[model samples]
Target: MEQSDRAYQRALREQLARNELTFAHAPIGQAIVELDGTWRQVNGALLQMLEYDEVELLAMTFQDITHPEDLDLDLGLLQQTLAGEITSYQMEKRYFTRTGRTVWALLSVALVRGLDDEPLYFISQILDITSHKKQVQALQDFTAMLAHDLRTPASVIAGFAQLLSTGPYDDEVTSIARRIERASTTIVDLLENALTTESIDSGRLTARPTALDVRDAVGTAVQAALSAAEMNEQELEVDTSGLVPAVAWVDPVHLEQVMTNLIGNARKYGGPHVRVTTQVHDRRVEILVEDDGPGVPPRFVPQLFERYSRAQEARTGSQRGSGLGLYIVRDLLTANNGTIDYEKAALGGAGFRVSLPAA
Candidate 1:
């Protein structure tokens, strides 16, 4: 009877080992880790994700690929699972892939116990969710831009409607009508340009190139903006001193649109007048649009690029904007193989620098 029992125990041990290995080599990312955090068995999917071989992985611990910020939380949850305080846990964490990319994942882990009910190993299942996160961000950006774009003309129309009661006078009524027309024109232009976009949730804009002089486009946009600047009692300056008048292969209309938004934002949010400067560097042409108003708060800088996200400054007065201006400018710039960045203007305000590839 004792010999038969011994044989049964040996068979059970062999079966368990086979099952662990079978799980390790499965199609999805799975791993068996010791309670001490050392990886005991890693499946093929996990190995490919981390870009490590079976032999090399067994020598490392889970702490290795975990993002520094997420490490402590992971450890705490792991401790709870091992102590039987929790049966299992799931979390979103980042892992540094072998190629130096931060891989985002949804990780589920459970405690594996021995026959004596003592902690033995941990089982983990990881689902890659990086692409999902990006799509979510894009959708959020699209929604914000739409609100900003659609609201601008509506607000202008409302303002004009209020002024109509003060004007049975011919000139006054005509001026109001013209302003209303311009506001409606703005709305029509935006719709015409953007309404045909591919699904914002499923895709993004791409660039199309044509031969055009970006410098000439800047001059035209500046001329258009000068009227608004004058009305604001501000001086609009144009500096093409550094510009090389050459045609570039890009969508000239898009560049004009980018300038329109930037210059308009300057008039709305900046101090009197704005400066538009152009220059060429290496393979790219650059435009700098600056205003003398108070620059964005340091804390708000990161959020400034987010669509429809207004600054606290905008909340204080009529200086406020739809916040879609810069975001739309950025998206358009991206579609044209260009880039935009913010800086503190030497003139004691905010500055936006735009760069586009040269022909």
Candidate 2:
């Protein structure tokens, strides 16, 4: 061969090697198809994605392995690309693997042309996006659940609130009025917590942490829990013996909500009297809420911070709760660098403790 031809051949060989490596080791699946849809070349990733060996894939056309539901759309886009009306198209499509399992892919297709501007082949890049699709579906399901679960309690509160406002009632009637108000307040708190959690998950909630007097904050939360305690015929007591000047570096509003939710939970599931006590340690401020009711089931302790996770036995018996409260409480505490835990109280019931960094 002439010197010029040898140099040309060497360059061509290097180019061929580069192309082979790019196709075989590309992060995304790649393929080349002729105008008739026959796959002339496929990358290792594409072959692996389709669960097919190179020999098996080489014999099949792109359309043959496409999911039945996606074939029409895929072909339509490919036709558009070939017609020169569009240079490229991207879509979330599905294809069938050798084992018949459907694989989701984000596919981008483009037409490759020769120097004469004639269609040479089609090039495609595919990314597996099944995980993203599943996350979107999960978010949709969560939104639906929130709407349905929240509406029921809201309707109860609205119906009873109007009834209570309509006319004068006897002592018995007044007592029921109080119960309706308490239930309404509880539902409102739940809605707020749900919205707050959504904001936090979406990275929209910003905590305004400040120096807050732990004693005053606990007093405010205790006041909010009083009505709930009264409705349940439970007594709520707050003792700040060692917390007279107790202060913590935290978001006051968030901390108050956490305390109210904890105390309310104790009142709802704990026996008759629930006591909230605050104390200050060397580096942390501790708030302990204890109830006298049946303690939490041992198995449920680990999942206390998970959303919608309630003890089946507790829900079945006398302690039915929406189960979002504790989850929200934990999230709020975590955001503020605080910690909470569930334990069997020395008072013979469930104990929820919140520890915050001292101011």
Candidate 3:
């Protein structure tokens, strides 16, 4: 009895869908597609979607207008549905409209059977998603501009301040110079984070892994961040004690950037004196950074590496950050087969351990 009821309900739906006999209209594209990919009937919405006149479209098969890259995927899915392996399938695909412009749409197709359980035709529905795609692209372009316009000047300002700090100067003058460099560094970091985040979101990140001395990379990054530490009235200590230099498989530039970000973030939100230690174990190299300041609140630790996350103390600090630093660092590390972890430091501060595969 249930089987008969289901069959009857299916028949009713097919009847409503076929009401081309009654002049019903749909706001989204709908069509009856023949097994050979030709259109048996097309609604007004489908005609507008393809930018085609009814007379022209009826003469062309669906494959005649699909984007070349998407054609195989669409056909494969259709074959799966027709073979009884699936009931229906929906996918995002592209089409070339009559005017040669590309259209993106959510294309859904279902196999329809006659009362005798034999194939009749397929029902296809298309929802235009081109506008959404355009919105996303526009956002990415604006983000790119934000990164470029802000980072360039920040770099210049940091460079000049670094040069200025090298002079013999009074305590006050040197202090001001240090602060300026740190502030400029912050600007560059935030802007670079924007670009890194965009690359991560778009899956376009590039990594060139090579064997390099990680100890030297850490030392270089620490030297790069010395101005910022000084600006915070903090001392940075590097402990390479008993540490034989190890070659690690990583993108050197990215690893250095991650170290710079880590050191900067530590100096920003943690205590004054910071310690950086390096070690190697079990085919991995570890760089440990710890600060002698207040550790991250236990509650905030779980959210540390999340995008746009900032510690509560950082939110109220004199210098503000864009809250994207650690997130970008994590992404950069993962791209190069490295990893970062945060733990409470035995030095009564926050500790971060970065591990990379030894080359």
Candidate 4:
């Protein structure tokens, strides 16, 4: 019996030694904190992550190193975990390093308990994400700069091409100018989508919904799309027979953008004919853009409005798109308290239906 007891003790010691080694040398920052938030134990990775020595970190609470803006949320989650409301919690939060640099981290934490189920300490794992965050910020800044810087030149090119198209040019020159105009217009549209996406991501794009004439908005979009339609040799038509004036409660600018994107997409991807129709249903305004080209494949429909997602056919087709138009349309519609969806078009091709609330 004494030998058996000694063997059991030996096994327990081995288990504890392995656990201690794992805890001390894990790649990510790990810590054990008292219920009151004081640091009880911290690993070398935690010290390295915060640029603090073991003694320095041991003397400070988690709150001392967490970013002020993120402290409340962290504290709230900790409390919930302690109260047994949550078994564990994870979040992306910012921390202040010893050198006063702000860094981001993915933090996962759980509470420890005694045999009697009494709260003991909290264990936390923090994965440094500062580099990833910085990369994302850099990419966004570059995209914004590219979009803004290219807009003027693209617009100028489009304007010149339009003038050339009408300036007594021969058929060959006229055709080339029209092609230039189309390409420049496409660039401008892509830039606009990028800028709008940046605005939405930064919370700068907002909708001011008001009583709007759906037909007028649709008419404006149709007029703007006519040149592109003509270039594509596609017939475009609009039917506003049943749409009541001033029935849509939407931001006029947003509505116009949505319509333009829908019409533009049809011109690019649809068949030789496109039709836009509006109806009033249950006091809501519904706008449908339909094209006669081969409709979107069934499998691609689910991801149609996703940013940067394109159908395989589109990716291989003659027309190149940034794949941002439909995404922007959906976002703008959502901002204006509206919705859009895809369907089989009545014209035997792709269709998009936009619905807006009644004013």
Candidate 5:
């Protein structure tokens, strides 16, 4: 051969070697299959992914190794690509290995054509996504267990605290007992709210709805909140104007908890004069709790209902209640098919509105 021809041949050999290296070391599993789905060519990753040798894989069709449940959809997409209806397709599919274990893969398939534009083979690129799927499933199970465990302890703490407060005790030690009770109550609230938020996020909460008298529920909540309001030297007002004793189909305990939280929050955060009003509409009933204290900080309103969130800037002093009140309120309302929102109060303070479906 001439000197120039020798150089050209050397360069061609180097180019071919580079191409071979690229195919062997590619990160994704790559394979070329004939129209009948027989493996014509496969890279190193492909062979390792299927746990098969080159000769073994070449003797089998793609359908032979695909998961039985996923084969139909995979074949449908392949047929579409072959029929010229689509150029390529991608899907999360599964394949079975020789050891009978399933492997999850994200498969991308493209049609390869010859110089004459006639389809020659199908090219597939696959990525193992089994690890990612396992992580997601584990996270879901953890959330469910966390929610279940937290609620029982919370109920016990709150129940015992209530028992201690109402149980017989000396007048001198009553204050200390009350403080202990308060601290325990706060912890209980935090746990309950956190668990409820997790339950809502995981779609595990269920509501047993029934007809309830809105006025009676609100009255009971107001009575419960009055003690807190009086402790803060705050005035509690109830405005049931145009609101009759209407019945609503809701979870009574959940709705009562919602009312209690909203009222208690208003008393804790509002100015000296706190007003709770109720209005009945055609389709829904709206309860508004307004306070005269400095309103919630503009920035904190958006995340007020988030778990463990506190409106520190909006709080009056170091005497802050559990930051979980609004979060619990939101969760309870959601469970009862209701909604809550915070806005500037018409009475120059913070306003919280709870809307419940009418019976």
Candidate 6:
């Protein structure tokens, strides 16, 4: 019995040593916190991440370094984990460093329990995401600059060109103004998409769904895109005989944005003829936009709606795009509790179907 006990003690000590070595050398921040939020142990990575020495961190609780606005959510989730409601929790949270700089981390935490199944302490792993967060902020700032610097000049140029096209200008001059108008309008639309992307990505835009006539939204989008279609010599048509006029429960602004993107996409990439139609399916409203151009290549269909995704044709074609339109459409539809799908059209081109809840 004495030999057996000695062997067991040696095995346990080896296990503990291995655990200590792993904890000390982890690449990311790792910490053990007491049940009452006091820092019981911390690794060197955590010390560097927080710009705090080991002694200072051990003397402080997580609450002391967490941002005030994020503290409540963190505490709530921690309480839930402690009460056996959750096994673990993960969140992107802000932490204030010892030097007073705010940093972002993807924090994952799990409770460590004793042999009797009682809570002993919390183990947390924090992966710093501060660099990624800064990159996203920079992109948003650039988009804002585009909206402010380019949109105003483009709109003014388009307005003057429109007047010259319809006013008492010579035919030759009128034709030049019409070309300028088309170019400027395209610029304005692209800028609008950039601004919308920034708003959506930053969570500043929200969908307010309501029961409204789908026809009005479709009409507005069709009218807004008609000029562009005409400039490309594409025919645009709409058919809504099968739709119930007041059944769609969607945000009106978002619905229009969706339609505009679809119609514009068909005009820019699809064949020379485009059609918009509506129907009812499974108590939902489906708006279908199709064109007679060559369909999307099969290989690119899977990522067609992803942000900044462009087909080879689009990249090499004369009509260049920012690759933001389809991504924005999908996001706006999702916000309104709607969905969009793509298929090969019977018209020998690309097809898009947007579905929304019925009121």
TM-score of each: 0.52, 0.57, 0.74, 0.87, 0.60, 0.78
Quantify all predictions' global Cα lDDT against the true fold.
Answer: 0.75, 0.80, 0.84, 0.87, 0.78, 0.87
Instruction: List candidate 3 segments past 4 Å from native.
Output: 1-26, 30-43, 53-92, 106-125, 165-179, 235-238, 273-283, 346-348
lDDT of 6 at 162: 84
Candidate 2 accuracy as lDDT: 0.80
In model 6, where is the ten-residue run with the lowest total lDDT?
Answer: 237-246
lDDT order, best first, reads: 4, 6, 3, 2, 5, 1
**Cα lDDT tens digits for candidate 2, 190-268:** 6667777676666566678998887777777777667556565666654435345768889988988888788777766
Candidate 6 lDDT? 0.87
Model 5 bad stretches (over 4 Å): 1-168, 227-243, 305-308, 312-337
Name the runs in model 4 displaced over 4 angstroms.
55-60, 72-86, 112-120, 240-242, 280-284
- Which of candidates 2 and 3 reaches a greater TM-score? 3
Better of 1 and 4 by lDDT: 4
Most accurate candidate by lDDT: 4
Best model number under TM-score? 4
249-295 per-residue lDDT for model 3 (tens digits)? 99987888898888777666665667787788899988888877788
Residue-wise C-alpha lDDT for candidate 1, range 130-168, written one tens digit per residue:
889888768767855784577666656745743562457
Clashes of each: 2, 1, 1, 1, 1, 1
Report each candidate's C-alpha RMSD, comma-separated, in the order given: 12.9, 14.5, 5.2, 2.8, 6.8, 4.2
Pick the winner on TM-score between candidates 1 and 3: 3
Write model 6 residue lDDT over 1-359, tens digit each, in one string: 99999999999999999999899999999999999999999998889999999999999999999999999999999999999999899999999999999999999999998999899999999999999999989988987986969999999999999888777988899888888888898899889888889888788889889897788887788777677766555566544354445478998888888888888788778857777777876888888888887878899999899989889999998776888999999999999888999999877799998889987
Q: Give per-residue CA lDDT, model 4, range 117-169, as digits (tens).
A: 99999999999999999998899999999999999999999999989987897
Q: Model 6 misses residue 299 by how many Å?
A: 1.4
How well does model 4 score by local distance difference test? 0.87
Sorted by TM-score, highest first, which candidate order results?
4, 6, 3, 5, 2, 1
lDDT of 5 by residue, 1-359 (tens): 69999999999999999987887799989888898899888998888878999999999999999998899999999999988999999998999877778889999999997898788999888898989978876886786577577667766765665566666877646555566656655665555566666666667777888878787777877786775554334576655453466677788777777877776776666656667777778778787888787888898878888766787764557555657667778877877888998889998988998888988
Once fitted onto the true fold, the runs of candidate 6 whose alpha carbons sit more than 4 angstroms away are 1-28, 34-37, 44-56, 68-90, 97-101, 108-123, 127-135, 235-244, 281-283
